[model samples]
Target: MIKLKELSRLYNINKTIVEYGLIELLPRQHRPFSYTLMRIVLFWVRTKHQHLSLPERLRLSLQSLGPIYIKLGQMLSTRRDLLPPIYADQLAYLQDNVPPFCGELAIKQIESSLGKTIDELFENFDATALASASIAQVHTATLREDNREVVIKVIRPEIEKTIQADIQLMKWLAQLMQRFLKDSERLRPVEVVYEYEKTIIDELDLMREGANAIQLRRNFLGSKLLYVPEIYSDYCTKNVLVMERIYGIPVSDIDALEAQGTDLKLLAERGVETFFTQVFRDSFFHADMHPGNVFVSYDHPEDPLWIGIDCGIVGTLNNEDKRYLAENFLAFFNRDYRQVAQLHIDSGWVPEDTPLEEFEFAIRAVCEPIFEKPLSEISFAAVLINLFNTARRYNMKVQPQLVLLQKTLLYIEGLGRQLYPQLDLWDTAKPFLEDWMKEQVSPTNLLKKLQQKAPFWLEKLPDLPELVYHNLASGKSLQKQQKQLIVSITKQQQKNSKSYFYIGIAATLTLVSTLAYLQTDKNLAMIAGIPGLFAWFLAWRHTNNE
Candidate 1:
């Protein structure tokens, strides 16, 4: 029932559309009732009617729904193919910003989490937030002796309860959808909820995010590909995290980046290379590559370096997925749409019964025109969306793990476009994946396997002779045991036969003796017959027991 309210409330969302002037911008304008219906509903609760632009209404709606719906709006905004241009344009303006709880409340949260006063824990802490988001906010600080600048992040105390309540409502909606909605299973809404649950819950743990940052930092430790900030483990807790503060311009400031003399083209290409390195080489990547979370270093402005933040939503792929994905991308580059379609079926992304030839043609129809143009003109995210839609017709399944990877790719490409319009993503990323594939299947992997197996082989080496000898000894022992058991059963059967024969003989002798003594006593005949009958009954009883 609560689930119904949660879904119903979104449709009845007040204020946002009216405030932003989106009452006139409902999607189906060709149908005349669209605008009037939306306007009536949107203006329901306004004391003073206010006019807002299309984008403004979107931002207001996102803010009104709070974090969960804001996140959904953020995701939907990325889907350029799925949404109309006007709506997409407006949705792009949606922001995650919220009024932070309070400076004192944040202080209390940090102190309680660390079990120490702010001064004892840090030499200095800025009361004002450097940045704030849905679940947490960051504050700039410094150590007592080293005097190095660092950022401390703390989770809002009641944020978990709020998120949990929203999640429960989402789950309830998904369950209802499965029971009553057509094509709900096709979307796998329940599984999607569970995946969202895992992702958001994982983000609540600051230490886990700290470890994530550290591991991603290690992956590119000495490289210029991407820089993940160092995590200060000593200061990390479930609710609090302190990490190195970096200085770089936000990627959104194109004019500022240009003023710094950054080579926008090379920077765009490098971004693509960094993405490939993380996915193919490291198999772990910073999943949240949204524009707000990324920054460009001016130190080497001509050859700009990327500073990545927010390690909360990283993605990983298993070995099989990595291989198939690499192969699929390579095939797409070669314009072998047939190979691409086959790879999907072979990897179990599509059902086995999907006709290979038809699927291949469908893929070619969708991708051929896109790749015919330059890479910059090609949107990798759009291509993927098309493929997924086509595959859906053929009963394809979404690999939940790949969702983060896809999201990151879209962000990387979007950022790249903002930096340089001529960025060729396919050209930049192909070489790296090809090189990594060769290394994965190289002789070095075989040698590494042998090295790993050395200890087990050595342990068995000393017992080789004893094992062989035991096997030979046991072979004859089993045959001999079987023969002895068979012989014993045969002897038992012969004993039964001998006992019957003896009984028959005794009965015949008793009868003969009775005939010879018949003249002496008539009673002797009856006694002889009785002995015969007794022997026969005894023999019959013995046979029955057997």
Candidate 2:
């Protein structure tokens, strides 16, 4: 059953799709009969954006739908495997450029979340939003305790309900696609929607975002490559987050960056270095690296520092993934297509039965052309995209775990090239990967691992002798029990043999008695019968005695 509100929302969504001319974007042959009926039913909702390209209109329809749809578009942009390059390229321009909600409402929500009045919590609080995004908006304030400038982020009122409703609709639509589309399995529409749902839902919890920001800030505390803003924990809540305010030039402002004499080349290289360091050294990275969330610190123009904001979304890699990924990158750098193919099999990214030679040839075919140009002209993201596409033909499933990593890599590479066109990503990353690989097997790393486990080892050291003694005693006890069991079995077998012998004698006597009776010999019969009875009693007594 559908509520009136949801039905109304759906109708509006359909209207937007029609107005943006999204249905025409699909092939005429592919469009379902229902689509034509929809056009007739909603005849008033004609196509309004005839001037825009199909991709552009598609992007506009999603944006007009709301925050959830806009976020969906942003996520889909990273999925180059599923969408064409033109659609993906247009969707990449999707931004969280939502209109700000009421400032009074934001203040009330913050006060309600913090359980205090706005004046009681802070001084010089600004009602106007510092920034407005899809999930939340930021407001500037001065903390009463420390007099430090900070930004307070508040979740929009009833945003979660809207997100949940939209997600439900998305899931329903995904099911329709899976049921009707010929090759929907390849698209994995349901799984993609579920992924987007989780990501958007996670962004709703401001406390998780605060923790992520804190961890990231600590990881890059003294680093020149990146700077994470300090989160004010005491004032933070699930719906409201307070963090130190930062005034840095947005990374997209190329003119401003150049005007400030910022070292663009070093800045670009540092971006690559920062990504590798987070992925390899720390195993944690800011997954959302769009220009809106990235900025340049004004303090260091000669040695630029990146200021990261909106740490609501982050990606982490375990040791296994990190190691395999490092090896894969190194293999790609060396043009070792065989090793690359082997790593995919070893990592269980592809089926073990996938022919090694065929996979290697396919990868080489797609990737070899990428290296023909100078290293500076090559695109790391392009190489990865080609590799993934080639692997898909061998029945390789998409790795949901690596989705964020792939998206982040695309963002970093694009940002790097935008800052410095001739950036040699391979040259910048190869040495770092080599050093990291060396560190994995180094004696120092071994010592470090030992140190990490020393406390546990020490805690159990006192119990070792007692545990050894108990184990030996239990073993001897078990052996003794085994011997006793063997003797008992032997005795039981002897008793059974004696019982069988008596029973055989009893049977012979009974047969003799019967033969005598048949011969009409009373005396002989009586004698035999009495003996048979005695033999039967003896056998019974023997069996009972054991």
Candidate 3:
């Protein structure tokens, strides 16, 4: 249910979207108020922004709407297939920068949450924020106990209320879309918003974020392709997180990277490799990987490395999804459209009743065009969108679990293209997928699985003899019961056979009587009727006896 307040907020949001020259994207017929009100808003607002492009206005409008919209805009910037190239390009530069809360308020928050004064906790705390974002601000500080350099991250004051209100509004809008729009089922608008809600809310808990960071750092321990910073857990809380402060070039600053003689192609390819390694090898990945949260290590310019930060959101896949995804990627790489179609039906992604040939043809049509270009020139994001749209025809259910993976891939791909235009995504990903698939079915992995479960098997081994004895006793008892049942069934069958015999005799006598009557022999017909009556009595007697 949508409250009046939420509806009003949605109306305001729609108005803002229209003012940003995105009214055409709205279902004008479904939203009559927006359609009419947009015309009026456009009339007044057109004069001031006639010179600005739609993409610029879109970025500005999203930033003004606050954190949630900014996040949505950032995700949309990588969707090269859904939007025009110019729009995607412009949105790619949408910044997450926001004004930081006052330093005094941040101090007050840290003191209250940690139950200690700033002086007690820090040897030297900077009043100014090192970085500010929609959710939190980071300030450089030194630990009083050890004089170690760290950054204190504080959640924005009273941010929960604002987020909650907007979340409600988004839910209402998603419901409206799913209810009224014919194509919204494939989009799964409500589930998408719910996923976004969970992610953003989790971001508020600095402790959980810290744990995520620690786990990711452990996963990539001593790796050269990517680096995750350590978390200082002793000083962390739900609202305040303290962690090792890192210094590196922002991933977006390509000029600085080039100036440092970083290998651009190697850097781009490494980004893709990092994503695959996280998802397939470790099953844990940094879900929020926009340029702002990523940096390049300054130490390795020739063999470039990535430094990941902002581990607020992470994604994991179950075994089934992992296998299916790996198989699908391999199939796609091999250009086996029929196998891809079959996999979709087998995996229950599409309905079983869907025509296989037609589905295969549709997939081929969507995937074939991309292969015309060299693998280096093909856009992975565009291919994904085309495949998704094509699958919508066969009624593929929206996969909510893969949402984060999709978003992260988009970010990585977009970033990769920016770093190196000729990066061959297929070439980078094919061998990785092949290796992952092989590892899944390898003897070593099977042995490892058994080894991991050996303890439980050993624990149950002592009871095996008793289990076997009981099983033997039960089998003997079942045999006796079966024999008794067979006897009863046999007796019943004999009684039915006797009844059928008597019935046959009665039928013959009746037929004889009818023949005698037809011959006009009255005496003979009366005699035959007496036997027919006798046979009927015998049949009834046999049935009664049984």
Top of the candidates by TM-score:
3
Candidate 2 lDDT tens digits, 124-213: 999988777778889998999879999999998988987888888877778888889754665567887888788778989999999999
Q: For each predicted model, how many residue pairs clash, with residues at least 3 apart or on different chains?
A: 2, 0, 0
Tens digit of per-residue lDDT, candidate 1, span 1-546: 565555555454545444545455545546466446666766565623356555556656675666676666665554555566566555554423555668898899888888889898777788888877667888888965578789999887788876777787778878888788766655677888899889988989999999999999998887876888888898899999989999998776788998889888988888889888888878898887766577888788876788998888888988899999999989988889889989998998888888999999999999988877877688887898788788778878767777788878887787786678777788888788778878888899889889999999999999999998998899889889989999988977887887678588667957765785767775766667677777777777766664
Worst 10 residues of 1 by lDDT: 88-97
The segments of candidate 2 whose C-alpha lies over 4 angstroms from its true place after superposition are 1-13, 23-38, 49-59, 72-96, 172-195, 465-546
Full-model lDDT for every candidate: 0.78, 0.86, 0.86
Better of 2 and 3 by lDDT: 2
How much is 269 displaced in model 2, in angstroms?
A: 1.2
| Residue pairs whose backbone atoms clash in candidate 3 | none
Each prediction's RMSD over C-alphas, in Å, is 11.0, 8.1, 5.5
TM-score of each: 0.78, 0.78, 0.83
